[model samples]
Target: MSIPLVIFLFAWFVFLVIFTFLALVSVVQMLRFGVAGPGTYLSTVTFLAVTGLVLGGVGLYLAGVDWNATLDIALTPLL
Candidate 1:
């Protein structure tokens, strides 16, 4: 793979992992701790962080990262 492709893949994967982890943490805290054991704060922080990350990823992808063209795979017409 090209260097730019590798870099884009790495960055996109990192963003996905972070977003998934934060979302899971938020769900677990809400279901397990509610507002107790500092879970409330943690959940809030994770949710906000994930939101920011997703927004940033979208912006980066839209700014002409050619590797991001793969994202259309998710929206492509399936046979």
Candidate 2:
């Protein structure tokens, strides 16, 4: 609800959308071009995109729950 939290959530949402979009694009390109085209590069991109999307989704869900508490819990271990 605070300005910084809202901004953080917005950025996180944007990243999730972008990651999901990239993943879909990567899969489509891989299928259309096969292994001979972009080859392993596409595969790598697809993997990273999938990982990012999953993690981002979890982050967004946590943010929706209680952003402050979630952030505190998440950062606690790091500190």
- Which residue segments of model 1 deviate by more than 4 Å? 35-53, 56-60, 68-79
Go through the candidates in order and give each one's C-alpha lDDT: 0.69, 0.69
- Off-target runs (Cα >4 Å) in candidate 2 are 1-4, 35-53, 56-65, 68-79
User: What tens digits encode model 1's per-residue C-alpha lDDT throughout 10-32?
Assistant: 88779879977987776776767
Cα error of candidate 2 at position 21, Å: 1.5
RMSD of each: 10.8, 6.6
What's model 2's overall lDDT? Answer: 0.69
Model 2 TM-score relative to the real fold: 0.46
Candidate 1, residue 55: the lDDT equals 76
Candidate 1: residue 66 lDDT (0-100) = 61
> Model 2 shows how many backbone clashes?
0
Model 1 TM: 0.37
